[model samples]
Target: MHPAHPLLAVTHPDPYPYYAALAREQPLYWDKTLGLWVASHPTAISAVMRHPAARVRPLTEPVPRGLCPGPAGELFSRFVRMNDSRLHTRIKTLLMAYLQAQSQQACTPQWPAITLLSAVQADRFLYAAPVHAQAAFLGLPDQLHADCAVQIQAYLTALPANANADLIAAGHTAALTLQDRLESHLLAAEASPALRQLRDDGARDGIPAALLAANLAGLLFQSCEAGAGLLGNALILAGRRSLDASTTPAAARTVIDHVVRHDPPLHNTRRFMGNAIEIQGQRIEAGQTVLLVLAAAAMIEPDNAWTFGAHGHACPGQTLARSHAADALLHLLHAGTDAHALASHFRYRPLLNARVPQFDFSKDHQP
Candidate 1:
């Protein structure tokens, strides 16, 4: 254990403060216990994330065999989690096509409806509205949305420390169940125009039904987790500013983008070193893992935070994600919510990876 490593603790909410110190003192700091190098500086992080020698592979080797056992193990083994370079690029290309299609059709149409629903259900159900809307966009039935949310939450709950063995088992079980449900839906959607077009366009395409299903479930799970965080953060910032109800959609987008840069959906992304390489005057051996703390890097040089990467790895979906958030905020502003009240309800998720808040609509809103 690196005595200075903040991640050693089970409940470290934000790792930025520690990361900043690391970047200043030990930009190439390595933790033996974790068997990974943590980079905090913008240049260092960007170099590591885009480094040619840095292989994007799963943590399959030296695996915590006990952590994920049985079916969860098998699922992880079979999924795209372990892919890299050629395979990763190929899969990502296919997935992008699918995502692009969905974004243009389903996502665009559903945003307004989702915003309306979120506002209507604000006082009564708060968080459930967006989760349900996510499920709806994925073509899931209304009844299954709550079940899906429960399953996702169960899985997340089992991830933190102090999680029980039984809880882990239950989370794995729910995940598998959700996977099965998603598979059935994907098969049904195969005949749909959008998906059919995707199927027809790609030749070497064999997007396993299981993969599509898992991806959909993963997207929703991620969206709810991260979207909620971003929304919460934005509300808090907007409230602090006492932003006018007449705030333009474009300005709201600027606020959301700033929030994402300051506190991204994921705190860091892990990559394995494929070969010996020198980064910031330190040589990292092959098979060594490197963790790029994006959230920390975002704050290092706030002015240049928007660039995802000098290389193409910058988030391709940034534009879309920004648009979606902007639209949602515009909807809230247009609905006549008071800026200060909206901000007051902002409370972020106490997770390390993402800095998202939980908005208490019931407490913040007025009739």
Candidate 2:
């Protein structure tokens, strides 16, 4: 069955055909059902994103209201992806240079271990593997990689408005711990040349170390769920092709790369208008939002990398994220995981945009 709407399509069993049609025939339209505009074609999506007044976060409520008055909110606000503050350009440039330089060093992620290759274990591994790899990429201690995943999960659980008091409190505590740890690492004498350079540049530019630390932690947050989706989808593609532990590392990476083009982790992203704008002959008022169907646009131009986004808001960690997912996949295969068996029995997690899969599940609930 077709999904009821674009947001619903993220979890739909087969959404590509619908997405293709969306990009072809209905490039941009008002989804009254969703109370916003939808941009499916590459042209329309680009138009909305390139507009200056279309900010990442809403103008009125910059940080999520639920997270306000809490450490979690502060950490969230400091992330480079969350705002277009004065320091944004400088911070992003610094991080980009740091990541590009760090990529040259040989670093292998310590893939999380599993006692069994059961469906439940795969579920846990999917989310943890990426965070573990990203933490290692940041030159964090091997012993702390697992803790990074746990803390990030707890922190994420507390972001939504309906979170319970206990979860929210736990999230605040987790945020503080992460901030302190990353800040210490960023300032430690033993830091790598690349990291040290980033620190010196941030200081020279008057960028706050606290903000730099939160963004360093933000790298983990960025990689977790989306990385799971990319890895999970790649596994499904591998299953269809009968890929196994015997597959060469090069072969595994090839499959992962294909997954990025055809079945990406993120399906759509949004742009909130700070001022009224006309796009594709449609007038969208201020405060309105345009849901950019990245997956849909990919159908039009596979190499465009609409999944990582485009323009100033494009994700700087694209290269790192892909390599991390590829390595994680190879690690899972070498661990004797039955990709075909696991892939045959799973459902997509109920996320607004990401398409992560859960191997262990009851038929009762999504995600």
Candidate 3:
């Protein structure tokens, strides 16, 4: 059975064929069911991404309504991923340079201590290990990596519009903790040269330490669901290939690369119009949302990292993300995780954009 729409395809057992057709045929069109314009082909997706009037966040609501008037809202708004301002360009350039430099540095990631690598614990590991790796990569102390993962989870839980008061409040607390920790780390005398360079560049450019620190936290935030999907899908591929505890990181990287080209993590991302625009002769009104089906674009151009997005809003952490997933995959296989069993029985989580597998039987079932 095929998914009814691109949105539903995230959890669908097989969506690539459908995505291929969307790129080849539909390209761009209105979906009354979703109340948005869908752009699947590379041409249409590129048109939307290149538009000056296309914004990452909605013009009327820069931050989610529920998160307004709070620390979480402030931190969320500061992230380069969520904006379309000059600040975005400056921070993005600085951060990209920082990541490139930092990738050359050596640091150890603290994998979560799972007493037993059951299906459920593997599910938990999917989210935790990536944050741990990313936090460590950012030059945060080893002891702080696990805590940073916990706080990132809390911050993520509070992002949805329907989050309860408790989650929202915890998110605020987590935001404060993350911001404080990253800021202090950034200012530490023993900070890495890459981090020091980042701080100095920010100061020279008039960017605040708080904003830079929030973006450091944003690096962890970026690693969560999409990272999970990458690692999870790679694990499935390893299992299918009978790669076990003996699989080296290099071998695991081979699987991860295959996943990137095939069962990639993110399926789509969105763009909000600051003004009305026309793409391929179809008019999208001001404030309207356009769904950019990156997976479909990948079907058209398998060589590109379409899942991370493109243009000004594209993710800056693609290389780091793949390396972390490879490391985490190798670690999980060696930890006695039954990759074959996991590969045999799992369901995709109900996410709108990412296709992360959940092994716990209690949650969403296989599509």
Candidate 4:
């Protein structure tokens, strides 16, 4: 029951029990070994997320030589977890055009095909579907979908501790491959009239091209893994509840939200304390790392109803992600197909930062 045992809870598959204990016993307890405080209460969690002193940092700062390795190391170091606010803002702005384009394209005539492909492929076709969807929105060649799928799988399958060196090397190569494609697309977009128009007028202003590209690729990586896991989790939960196809869609959305609350893709976001702060009466030193457990807070907070900002630092993407999930579920439920067929294919792995599930669609679907 020591506060220093934070990793104990993290390593456990279902950390809710541990989180509940921490919430009751040590709402703002600091772990000396981990050099971070666990804020388990809703108020504490919100405070940490919105606090001006809270700043994102690398999971392991000053990344060791030969640790991440090669292209993967370079990309991770350059783009993510560097704690540069100016760069982050720039990237966020630049990607707005692509995000908007994605939104617009989803409503077009091509949507039915894309939706059908997503439904039929489910988890198995994560690479092709998401890439194709992205390509459609970005106006890239659809032929790259297969290559993107292979690269993504390699990246996801890499182990954390005691990982195979060869696998890591493959991951680096995959990242480079995707990076090249993304760069090419960016260059082409700069020259095209339609893409140029969007880039000039629609894209968020003041974003650097490099940062924009990095964030776009990062988004793809995040969404591909999370989206697949969510689809699988939703289907399984719906079937276990014995919900009918008509009701399954709505139930799926509820279950997905619950999953995000109970077992989110990301367990924590690392933030470095910029100034001395007190939480629940304990003073924390500056430069300390604060692990904000969004998933744990979401579960512990009252779920009386769905509302934006229900708890502080509530996801801005909550509405959009939920809407997408709801729509996907509804489409699946009304497909005149057995819902259970898709539910049984989920298999999960222990992800360090997020909960990821492996999906197999070749089980029993008659196509």
Instruction: Please tell me which predicted candidate would have the highest lDDT against the true structure.
Output: 3
Q: lDDT tens digits, residues 1-367, model 3?
A: 7689999999999899999988999999999999999999999999999999999999999999889889999999999999988899999999999999898899889888887688888888999999999998987878888898889999999998989999999999999999999899999999999999999999999999999999998999999889999999999999899888898878989999999999999999999999998888889999899999999999999999899898888889998899999999999888777789899998888889999999996854321
Per-residue alpha-carbon lDDT of model 2 for 238-301, expressed as tens digits? 8888888788878888987898898999998988999999887889999998899999999999
Q: Rank the candidates by TM-score, best first.
A: 3, 2, 1, 4
Model 1 scores worst on lDDT over the 10 consecutive residues at 108-117
On TM-score, who's better, 2 or 3? 3
- The residue ranges of model 4 lying beyond 4 angstroms of the native Cα positions read 1-21, 32-36, 51-53, 59-69, 78-82, 107-139, 157-161, 189-198, 201-208, 243-264, 273-280, 285-288, 300-320, 323-348, 357-367
- TM-score each candidate: 0.72, 0.97, 0.98, 0.70
CA RMSD of each candidate after superposition: 5.9, 1.5, 1.8, 6.1
User: Candidate 4 lDDT (Cα, whole model)?
Assistant: 0.54
For model 2, state the Cα shift of residue 367 in Å: 9.4
Which digits, one per residue and each the tens of the lDDT, describe model 1 over residues 1-367?
A: 3325534321244545665566667666787866788876777877887777775563345223533775444444443433443445655566567667765655432332233324334332223434555666566766687777667766555555466888778767877877888768766745455556545544346656666667556655555555555555666667777776789887899888877765555566667887888888888888888877665565567665532433434544455555555666666667666657655544444455555554443454321
Among these predictions, the greatest TM-score belongs to 3
Q: Give the residue spans of candidate 3 off by over 4 A.
A: 363-367
- Which 10-residue window of candidate 4 scores lowest in summed lDDT? 108-117
lDDT on C-alpha atoms for all candidate structures: 0.59, 0.88, 0.91, 0.54
lDDT of 3: 0.91
What value of lDDT does candidate 2 attain over all alpha carbons?
Answer: 0.88
Q: With candidate 1 superimposed using the best TM-score fit, by how many Å does residue 17's alpha carbon deviate from the native?
A: 9.4
TM-score of 1: 0.72
